[model samples]
Target: MKADAFPYRAPWWLPGGNAQTLWAALASRRHFGPAPRWQRSRWNTPDGDFVDVDQALHPSAPDAPLLVLFHGLEGSSASQYAVAFADFAAAHGLAYAVPHFRGCSGELNHAPRAYHSGDFAEIDWILRRFASEHPGRPLLAVGVSLGGNALMRWAGELGDAAAQQVRAIASVCSPLDLAAGGHAIGRGFNRLVYTRMFMRSMVPKALKKLEQHPGLFDREALLGARDLYEFDNLFTAPLHGFRDTADYWSRASAKPVLHRIRVPALALNARNDPFVPANSLPTAQDAGTHVTLWQPAQGGHVGFPVSHGPFGLPGHVRAMPEAVGHWLLTHL
Candidate 1:
């Protein structure tokens, strides 16, 4: 499938990359209607840290399709995209789960390790547990940004084994090439806006974690990181056992292994995404037969705003859920 199969057009009122990217966390928050009651489950890892999984299900249905959602950098249950997707899934009577990365589930996670862009082991644990708990239901997934990258990487690495776990998968606005993505978001205007937003949430949590596990590293160096690369170099790389940011970025990127994926998957990205450049977006040939890179020219990052809808309701309709939801509905 190509981008033409599921066309998306941004509303004229909200033009440009900045408008669409920022609106979800700003203007679109007020439009969130009644939310689903998400049952929370916290998993304590062998490493002493923990991750949280929030499940939103249809009360009447004992068995339903499950879409495991993975949020972006520093995002949680309250993140604009997560909340919107949860409610949207509930409205559609789909069973969904949102797994919060370590140190991102309201309270600080224990131990020295935290989540990174390529935490495939953690993702595998979550997927395995969910599959076991649900038994026979068809398992699907939709990952946003960082989580999307890891999910794609896992699929690529697993090859045929992935098909057994997930029937189909969707990844939105993920940084397939971590080195390219880092360079794009680590400089110029993105450094000021996007970088600041990520750090604002990440830094506090890092500091708190450092306090819990003393003598871990230099706190000042972490506080001084001005870009994504620098943050990885100063804290994430060392904590995760990588030599440097380059090492971490290169090893964690999904681009190198995408061709190995055997499960049917859709990789959606906006050509004008602020953090990921158009040149870095995957081509159909690059993704092999199992994957398609559906990139629209205009939807900035994960935002696909449409002014008109079924009842003429106007707001930023999140494309991640719309595309993934529609695909899962028909494919499953």
Candidate 2:
């Protein structure tokens, strides 16, 4: 789909990227209405770890399309965007599920390894399990931020094989170019605000991981790390088997493998997204014929707050998900 055809316009009341991004976290829930009920299930991983998944409580037809959401860093099923998408799926008579990455789900994972942006093996396992369980049901997947990059990597790695597992996929505000995004988030106001916000939870999680497996990484270095780059250097890189921050960012990036995706895929990003640099976003040529790029001038890292509706009235954060969800359905 074309970028302008996306039908998302930032509200005058919610100006700029930061405001839109923060509004989704702080206020979009109120406007989007109450969150839908969720049913939690724990799945055992092949490596003896457990991951929790939250499925929307609303019932759909037995053959209804299943929408699986892989959330951003430090995000869960209860996240504002996840709840909003649940509501959207319910409204459209679709089944929805949100799978939490290790360490992000309330409880820290037992294994010393943690999830990362290039954790496509984990994504492959999760999606394949979902496909197997649902048999003939059509499956659709959407990954937000970190999850998106991983999901895309999985699709690219598997190539045409992915077409059998999922009908379509969408990535919202994902940092496709991890190197660009990693350095961007560690500098300027992004470091002060967004990076700090993520580190608060991440550092504690890493500390807990250290406690689980003593001497996993340096204690003082982990504590002293100021930004994601430093934090990854101290903790994430070693735990996930990367040599260092540089190696992790480069290899984990989804940009280089975009051309390998054989299934229909949508990569949506805002030019002004605080986390993903505009220059790093993929074009049609970069992503290949099967992938579509939607680089709106606004939306702010999965925060697309609309000002006007079709009736010329107020709009909410549901606009982006609804549009993306419709796009996914159309591909099916």
Candidate 3:
């Protein structure tokens, strides 16, 4: 069967109903293996602050086009998807770097401000710095999940400006409609599991931020928040200058910005992606002329496992990075 022919149709209840099973599988797939080697560095932001970055280079190809990778919420370069994608890029003689969002590089950010889905200024800073250092090399951007949303938003806002520097862009499993995604994730047992798991990581970060910046956030609100919406309402919204969670979600979702993208780009989504509903996808007609939407059937969220040959292939996963790398190599 052709790779694109794998069943992409999904049921309406899929995003909300199968949350636990799907997320559990994703967590297992992401955590089961040892991380690949990467060198850590610090990039000084324009604000006189610093952000940590992890770079995996193709030792033999230092002058190759650089691929800037962005991981999902609460994920860093250590994420399995990030590492695997880096490996694939390196194999293709591409140099890749994954920047750790504030507080995500195993070190807490110094300020109360944390990373958000629509924060493009930091990315702009990174790109400008890269351009200055590399001078002539092309730059490509690739992101997964939350990072995907950020990249799309930035591309949309940049419009024609992105064409001057970005050779190509690719995003996988990005939630184009954050409000819809939050609503979907809040239903039934999914709400309990996803909220619990995410909060386990987020609440600690919030608490640490509170300690660093006294009176910065509502401690009681952070502790009592039950879902991502509530958590963002109390924490992310105020810190980012948004009026509320709804406002933040509305501004952050990438659907409104897809048409503005003017560079060669690819958006891939699994029909059965547990975090994003299929209906929430940015309409194909709405995409820019340079954009390609690759919808594959079986990959659940980031799960693209395929069985090979007669013996039932176990413990194997076909991730999105392979397709992304192939497309980048062909187009860029």
Candidate 4:
């Protein structure tokens, strides 16, 4: 989508990337509508492991379009963006499901491996299963942050065949270029804030995975890791069958394969996103005809706040999801 056509405008009170991002994470929940009642289902993966998918409870006609949301790293169905989309899906009479990436649904996964930005194979099977169950119902998908990159990678890898499983897809604040994102998140304020925030949960989970499978990786190396690159080198790369962090980031990035997407897809990124540098984003020509690029001037990471509350309180973070969800629904 063209920049002018995009609907997000960062509120004056929520100026810059950091403020908007922090508010969306910490305060946006209160501004959203009623929390969605969820029914959780466990699906055993083909690999002898299982993933839990949370379906939002909403009264809608049978065979209504199913909206599958893939949450970001360490994010689940209850994430701020996921909950907001659940509200949007309910209002539009759509079926909504958020599939938790392995080990993210609360219970530690049985498998030694965990989710990553380029986990397209995992995305492929999960989406395929959803399609098989839904049958003729229209299937629409939205991926937030890391989930977005994985979903797009799945699309690009399948090319024309992706249309069979999903009608349309949208990604919000995804770091399509994994190498750039990895480097960006490793330095300065981003390293101190966002990287540590993610590592706080990630490191502990990885250590637990080691306990599940002895000698999976070096415990000292994992413990000594300070940034995403070091962490991935110790855990994410080897377990997932990559040479190292360099190999993983280069091979996992969706930007290189975006032009291969055959179905209608939207790749929305904020120019100000701290995790994803503006220079690393793909252009319209780079993404090809089937993809729509929305690089707005603001909206940090997955945070897009439109309206400030009474007396200049925190802004409401529903505009991005509403706009993106509408776009998905329109294609259906």
Per-residue error for 314 in candidate 2, Å, reads 8.9
List all candidate RMSDs to the true structure.
2.1, 2.1, 3.9, 1.2
User: Which candidate leads the pack in TM-score?
Assistant: 4
* Count of backbone clashes, every candidate in sequence: 0, 0, 2, 0
lDDT of 4 by residue, 174-259 (tens): 99999999999999999999999999999999999999999999999899999999999999999899999999999999989999
Q: Candidate 1's residue-wise lDDT over 1-332, tens digit each?
A: 35555577777777877788877566664224476567899887777677889887445255777878988888877777777777667767678889998878788877788888888878788888888888767888878899999899889888898877888888888999999999999788888898898889888888887898898878888888888888899789889989999999999998888889888888988888888899988887788888877888887877776665564345756555766688766767
Q: Rank the candidates by lDDT, best first.
A: 4, 2, 1, 3
Off by over 4 Å in 1: 1-3, 29-33, 57-60, 308-314, 318-320
For candidate 1, report its TM-score. 0.94
The alpha-carbon deviation from the true structure for residue 83 of candidate 1, after best TM-score superposition, in angstroms, is 2.2
Q: How much is the lDDT of residue 270 in candidate 1?
A: 86
Better of 2 and 3 by TM-score: 2
Extract clashing residue pairs from model 4: none
Cα lDDT listed for each candidate: 0.80, 0.88, 0.74, 0.90
Model 3's TM-score against the true structure? 0.89
* Model 3 Cα lDDT, one tens digit per residue, 1-332: 01352343322333432542353245333322344568889887766567998877446355688888888889888776786677676667777789888889998877668999888777777777777777666788888888888888888889999877688888888887888888877777657776688889999989999999899988987898988989999999889889999999999888788888888778887766667888887667767576788776546666554433355334234345766877776666
Which residue runs does candidate 4 get wrong by more than 4 Å? Answer: 1-4, 30-32
What is candidate 4's TM-score against the reference?
A: 0.97
Tens digit per residue, CA lDDT, model 2, 1-332:
33555856787777788888988777664225456888889999999999998888888999999999999998998887888899889888899999999977788989999889999999999999899989868999999999999999999999999998999999999999999999999899999999999999899898989899999999898899999999989888888899999999999999899999999999999998999999999887779888888888888888897654565334467888888999999988
What is residue 251's positional error in candidate 4, in angstroms? 0.5
